[model samples]
Target: MQKVTLYTKLNCHLCQDVYMMLMELTLETPLEIDLVDITHAHNSHIRAKYTDRIPVLARPQSEVELEWPFTMADIRAFLSDPAPDS
Candidate 1:
């Protein structure tokens, strides 16, 4: 299983779109999705980092972070690979 985390905020259309995409991807892939709402995060650091970068996709323990404007193809490729590309 692959662990996935999405940084997001409330009422963001882009973030909502990404959330829906992630849900759809689940039918074809094994992804454990965790959503982080920067709007109400307890951690100030996390809120600060993703304030303007909502809809970012991150895999735990991997340095690679996917920002907005990513396609379903990009998500598919990322889920299929275990390691972050160098």
Candidate 2:
């Protein structure tokens, strides 16, 4: 299974749109998602790193990150990309 982490903040329209897209995608794609609100997170590192990019999707274990302004086709390609170690 693929692991996805979402960096988001409240009241961010882009973040909401990305979230909706991911949710809609789950209907046809099988992947687990973790939503993290970086704005108020206890870990300042994450907040600092993603404040400008609210809607970031990352595969932590693989160190792969996908920023916003992405289409469904982009997401599909991201998921299909081979893992770094593979």
C-alpha RMSD by candidate, in order: 2.4, 1.8
Clashes of 1: 0
**lDDT for residue 12 in candidate 2, whole number 0-100:** 88
lDDT of candidate 2 over 58-85, digit per residue (tens)? 8867778999889888888887788662
Which candidate leads in lDDT?
Answer: 1
Query: For candidate 2, what is the TM-score?
Result: 0.89
lDDT of 2 at 8: 93
Tell me model 1's lDDT, rounded to 2 decimals: 0.86
- Residue pairs with colliding backbones in model 2 are none
Clash count in backbone of candidate 2:
0
Which predicted model would earn the best TM-score?
2
lDDT of 2 at 5: 85
**Model 1 Cα lDDT, one tens digit per residue, 1-86:** 77888999888999999989999998987778989998899999999998988889988878778898899999887777768632
Off by over 4 Å in 1: 84-86
Minimal lDDT window, size 10, model 2? 77-86
